[model samples]
Target: MLTPWRLFLCQMALNIFYHIAKEIGEMESKWRLLHKANIKLCSQLIFTFITWQMSGYLTTKNSSLCLGGQDIFATVRENSPTGEIIAHLSINGDPGASSIRLCLTGENADWFYLEGRTIRLNSSFSRTLDREVLGSVLIAALTCYEDDIIRSRYRIMVEILNENDNMPYYLEDTIQPRYISELLTVNSMVFTVKARDGDGDTITYMTDKSTADASYFRIDLPNSGMVILDKPLDYETKTQLQVVIFAVETTTKEKYSTTATVTVNVLDGDDQYPQFQPCAPVYEDGDHNICTNPVYSVNITETDEDAVLYFSPGPIHAEDGDKDILTPLVYSILSGDGNGRFTIDSKTGEISLRQRVENRLLTPSFRLRIMAAQVNDPKKYSVATALVHVVSENRFPPFFNKTVYKGFLIESSSPATLVTTYGNQVLVVQAIDRDFRDGINPKIHYTMQPLTGSNKLYHISQDGIVIAKTDRLRAFDRHILEVIATDEESGETAHASVDIEVLQRGQPVPRSPFGEERLFGDMNAGMAGGIAALVLLVAVTVLFLFLWLAKRRRERRDPADRGAVALGKHPNVEASSPIAPRHVL
Candidate 1:
């Protein structure tokens, strides 16, 4: 029905309308700029009004080209060539010879390129994704353009596939030395092994065959980085150990591993008690061990309070069973010598007196118990005993037991009445020398001093015996005698007084009074004095009462007589009104 020229015009008008509609769509969406040719064609078609109405009818039948903005996923081997094609993109609507162009946009555009409908790589990728540089996901937009006009956009994603290229290595280039106690229990975690894989693969840890005794150590696998001890360690045998560890990738096709050398130093622990050397012989007391010998004897010839008396109980030697080098043995006193008179050196275990032994009479000897223990473990110890003997020189005088003595005699008795005897005999003058243990003064002699009253009244013999000089007739006479005991060796003298009571013959001999009866007599005397005071008080009271009764009777009679006289003088005056003073009665 239409002519050739008209049909040609109609097709050109429809094409212009469709292009103008696309340009308007692109302007509304505000996508990336299209090519320079598409922009010039859209500007020229915009001036034709009839073409604008025809474009609506023609474009209504032809759907607009769209990319749907759907995401695409592709994976390629690592280190692939740049510009490698991954996948071809398809448009959803018809675009007829409009010069469709494709381009990448956004931050990932530098790494990717779009050629026609194909997505290609712009740069090579590493299998190990460096999130710090390229990030985890590559985000890019592929823009579709027709005749220099943008129609739609789509998102493209490309992931780099991993390759086994790098071996595992320790996380730290150089491992720090580790220290473990010798007393550490078996199967205890000593340290952790940290490693990393360049390919981001799971790493498994294992002890290398070159390690020192693999039976003593074990490694936990991928999940745990712990290295455990399989056997106990001793510092005495081996102080240090070297361990070789290997970290391998779990999923790598070719076994790729890295080695790390760790120096493990074994530390000392408080595992052994101190031991003493054979300085003295040890004696046992019912399962208890005691050290003897090294008998130290000192004669206390002089007295010095502040001087130090040094005596070596010999050097103390001890050794630890664990052979720990860091800790040493220390010595101390455990018991005996509670006064702290003896002290031992902590390092050498040598014993000495802190103060001088001034008097052997007081403390004759000292018994001390010394203990040696490890400084690290004080509770683990060993004990030994030391006996110290003291000898004393004669430096004191003889002392008498009693300062005075009493004796009785008859005035008219015969001569040699056997008054008293001394020197280890009956009624003797006892003297003791403190420097001797026997307490008896063997070199002591007794003599009597002259009496003042009668010169020859009494005499003392060499053996300490007092005898009457003559028969006397004096009643109630007392004689005093001084008996002196002298030490022949040291010339030290001790004296005692003897009081001799002379009683008349046939006079009742007085007996020594009992102590309890004397106390009872004193009580009776106090009670009698109290009774006499009470009797005197009662007698005084009775006399006062008798005088008072007599005075009252006289007062009564005087009043009756006055009444008779007053009645005769004036009847108004009453005579019975006058009374005696109360104090008089």
Candidate 2:
């Protein structure tokens, strides 16, 4: 290879010689020397032109030399399978030398070896498209510009491109759906996902084979989201389910997925049987069976899921001749309207017997039918029946009060008292009933009243106590008080009377005698006492005046009294009259 300065020096020398030769061109020797220098100049120009053409040709080639479309471009793979590379080059073409030298010029371009080289083509050698080259290798090919003259050239081209071999995957590696239903609707978009391929064309859309009815779910072609809903759901038959969906590539058929599920719960409505929780009191060994006593009472209850619900039953009829339904019947009760033998509560669907049986009469069997009807409809109803067994027991009612007391006492304060008072002492009425506190239906009420002929002075308490309202008492008052106690459940009542006496602790004093004695005593003693008091006051005043006068006369006789008195007349002067001779006289 020739340096730029060497080539310049050679050209300068040639120019000087050619000018000299032209001056002497008439001689053959000078003409031949000029011709040789010109040829040498032509060869250098041609070599430079060939180098310029090779660079342009390689830069714009169709990636490779070919006749029928086979083009193999060099490629570089880095962090990714496809990346970018840059190249730089320097070339020296020696016109006089036999070969050209080629070398890469930059850090990245060092991978290519372009040392001394030459381009040679045989008569039959043609450009082939599929020739493979090892990396950045710089090859020089010769092109002749003129007859018998040749120049070596250097060429390089960079090829950066893409690949398509990556598998399809969820953009986030996981996905979620708004909801999953036992019966999903068609075309509902479930998720949005994406993936990448190194080969640039490896991915496509497909279904997840693991999912139920895999064909039922599909992925969108462009955006890679899913659409689902293969069938209808029946909550009654099937309440819940699970499903899996996937994103897949069309070419490689590779897939990744996330799973989701839906829950469908069947609600309980007003369809259950109106069960008659346990009814009737459990029998005890100590209870005695009685005719008018209550056998049992049942409270009814029902359930529903609807916001509002109601219950109804057929018309209620008495099992016995009496109108009391709270009392038990002697046999199994049947509803007249429905297909059942048990008696159902018209308000609440509770069933119970109408009567209690004696231990000897107790039977081991009783059959009854119960039904539940809708409150809104008369015909809409459901029926259930039950068989009951009665065991021997002693359930019975308390006895009535028969021992009556004497006539009731008469006094004030009796109407509202819970207990009656005799001489300010309250009296209690002892009574008894055998029914259990809870078993007593409707409650018992007692009422008391004085005999009709008795004076208006007597009254009875609201609780049936008879007492005297007036303070006036009399012997043998003999007031008749009536006691009536009625059972609220059986409507049976009993009546009795009590004799009462109104007596005081002391005997009564005569009103006239007492008034006269008090009046005479006050009049006689008060008059005598007033006269005696006046006489004593006059005596005291006369005694005080007499004693005062006596003390004055005694003081006049004392000469000491005159010495102490100062005289209007002087001691040395004589009085005009005898009685005035001296102050003492």
Candidate 3:
């Protein structure tokens, strides 16, 4: 293979020299001009021509200037600083090769400079030599000069070796933040990020291992740059997530890399069951909390029947776990229905008793497991425990101290301030339950029932303190609310009226024995009662005197008047009326 390649190269060189000799022969006059100016160069050329004729080829081309090829190849790494020596030049045919004079010229000539026998990079054109921009090879003409004339010329092909200089960049529109439903299956592709390396190195993708959301994702195929979900997504625990991806050049010793942020917008999916409110939240991710529903409870008397029950810690309410997707929910008494005695409203979640509890001595309490399920998807459901305590029948119902309560609220007060009455004292709406010794029944619950459609302006705490958001109320705004006190255990309730008036800022409350001055007018009732009694006495005396005068006048006018005015034992009167003998004057 070597011998045949050499013969072919020799033949190609012979044809190239033949064409050069024919051209030189035609430029005889120019050669003479050069011979006259520089005899040494002409004489050398003549000897070279004679030798070419004798050997039948220009073997001089193969000396050191030519090695059966026209190009002088060299290699240098890209990004090499200026003055970096990449190649050493030589003129092997000439004894003083190390000291030979050489010149560079071509498209890439400025990229290099000659120093003695060494060639170095000259990067005055850019900040640094870039393989991506300069391409694989840099080309230039390297010529050996003798006597200030070009003796031989060759092409310099500097191979630009690659380096891990550039960071990988994501291609346009290759990756973007995504909003995905939490119901997305595990191991599903969430993102496909593509990047390119200028050096054409193999790229490997990696997720940030130290982040919390990293465990939720995995890069199964390192080279594919596909991001997959490693676990289930729960919108209840986390609504949003961030992932950091790294595009790395693995084969490079320096391991160049670039990073970008990916946001996983977890949308709500109808995949979770309804949860009882006043949620019992647990920290699922240290940074975010996940909530679980709580149990419900209420009490009913042994004789309770056909009565609706209100459970506490809030009502028997369950909200869909997916907050954004509030699908309709229905309630049912899954267990402890009390043998068809207990019934539940499918829509309102109200538990009612259809039959009376026969005996409290036998059954003290009923454990009711109530289930709330989404109407669209019944399988997605949750059960809450309802404890119903069955106690003896209530002998007496609760009653408020006053049939009507008058509460005063300052318009300048904040939402958290309690309602006050005259003299700036806290106004309490209290109830008395004769059944309880202290008249304070633990089972009695108070609520401020709205008289109108809106009740958000005021709130009544369990202790019967009315709090109004005075910021939402104007001065002199009067609100009438019906307050109800119900026995939570006996299901007996009492109602009372509350007149809440909004007072202007800095307006003084009237001093009165009764709470509010307007509700109970300011008047001395004791003095007024005494004056009324004295007037009644005077009227009685005056009426008696007038009656006596009338009787005397009538008796003097007529005997009949005397008889009519006389008592049964009248004194001896005139005998004109002997028939009325008993008449007394």
Candidate 4:
């Protein structure tokens, strides 16, 4: 502290100089020449003012008059009320109150005034004490004096204490939308934001959790002003993120805070390879997803050549997985076509055969590796399999042995009872395809073609077995079922009829209208002599009976011939003998 007694002296001396300068106007005024002789008086007054000094430094010469102390200090916050006392003026000598006076003066004197012994801010001044403009400390002088002579003087320092008056603010451009790539490395700095405190307080940064996208980012440090990515980014899920940042000051008595909203735009990165359409996802982890290309298949006959092949699932297609930018893709066959037997269109993934299949019996199926790659970048590509099955040409159409077949089933029997023919024999319907040995073709299929709507009472198996649902079949119910025989590869069909009669429970199945003959060709060479051998046996039995009859007739005719000879004398006897002989033969 600077003692007010000494500070007052310096302040008083400074005030005298200030008042003298204000009252003395310009010495060389226009009218001053009219009283040129008075210049001497003005010079004397100037001399007296120049020689004026306080007893402040009289200690070297032992002059007794002096102030108590020249070291005085005080503090007042910025924007302090006018008339707020900053320092008290004091004097050491025992001068009467009526003889001594005090005042504030110096370079910054106008900012304050004196009320007897106290120095305070002057509210009448147009400017106020703003810490932003006045800096840390304000300086002035205080002086005290006797009626005519300077007594003591001292310098006064009033520290301008800082106040939390300004709010923090962010630069206009720094908080605008920023573009970030989804392919950015983890734990890397995304962008930076900084806030300024006008009051010059140390500022720290923090993200507000109340915002929805706060979890995706974090502050690098309390005071770093650097925003970092807290987790990986996904463009597909979130294209933009908003973060609310708060810049605050806690060093002052009251907290000061400011907020800025930052938008981070996620840009699409060409980080994914081309993927085939109809994606089959196999694994998923948040935005990281994986899938496999499906294997496409199609069957063609060995005779087909130079034709565009169509696939089962769909035509071969692929696209860039980055949806925002659908980059064009090119297609080609990578392998399994070394002989150039197949060619593919690059833009449109179409496969065409070059020539006929020489030998499908040796190589039935071909697996070609098809690659789809981005046109701009060849390294980014995906490979899939195209399966082509070459089959033999179909020749013969299937046919049924009988146009219509009759079979009977007893009602009230267990479910899935088989129909029976004459003599309780199980009836079987068969179709013949001469292309195969034994007139049997595995490729041939059978189905019951409904003659009427809703045929739920019975069902047919793939192998042409007609089973009757006994529980559903009422007693004495008759059903006529139309069956179809199809040659699957040849696409030819043959139709036949199956007349099934549902007999009452405990009733026998009547004989077939076609007699004991077998309906199908399967009955050949079974438990019977062949037709040719039976004919030979019948002929031999007839010849033996004829020979025995001839022998009996000759024996009876010999007795008859002798009786006729004895009656040879009559003519009627001779004629009767010829007739008798003929009858006997």
The candidate maximizing TM-score is 4
**Clash count for each candidate, listed in order shown:** 4, 37, 2, 20
Q: In order, what lDDT does every prediction score?
A: 0.65, 0.41, 0.78, 0.77
Candidate 3 weakest lDDT stretch, 10 residues: 60-69
Q: Residues 107-175, candidate 2: write the lDDT tens digits.
A: 334333322332111111232111132223323222322123322222334333332334444454434
**Total clashes in model 1, counting residue pairs 3 or more apart in sequence or in different chains:** 4
lDDT for 426 (candidate 1): 36
Candidate 1 vs candidate 2, TM-score winner? 1
Better of 1 and 4 by lDDT: 4
lDDT of 4 by residue, 1-585 (tens): 334454454445545655665577754343334234453454454445444543334552354334664656889888887999987655554433566666677877787887755678875456778888878888888776666566677888888888778888887877889999999877789888877887988888999988888889998798888898998887877899999999888687667888899999999888778888778789998766789998887777878888998885788889898888889999999999749988999999999988778788888888999999999999999999999888776667789999988888887758778777778887778799888879887877888866754287767777777777888877656788898887755657889998887776666666757564432222345434476588889999999999999998877766556566656553344453446755755
Ranking by TM-score: 4, 3, 1, 2
Q: What ranking of all candidate models by lDDT puts the best one first?
A: 3, 4, 1, 2
> Candidate 2, overall lDDT?
0.41
Model 4 ranges with Cα > 4 A deviation: 1-73, 90-110, 114-116, 123-128, 139-156, 209-215, 283-288, 297-305, 310-313, 324-328, 356-365, 374-379, 389-585
Location of the lowest summed lDDT over 10 successive residues in candidate 4:
518-527
Q: What root-mean-square deviation over C-alphas does model 4 reach?
A: 25.2
Tens digit per residue, CA lDDT, model 3, 1-585 = 234444444445545655675687876555445434643443455555555686754454443342322457889888888999867755554424543457789999989987766779997545688989979999998887655556678888999899877889987566677898999999999888899998899999999999878888889899999999998898877888888899999988988899988888899998767888888877566656677777777777766789998777778888887898999998998889978888888998888888878788898888998899999999989888889888866788999888887777766746566888656788888889888789898878988777864378878878888888877887777888999998887778999988877777665666654543442223355766787899999999999999999988865786755555554544456445556544532
Top candidate (lDDT)? 3
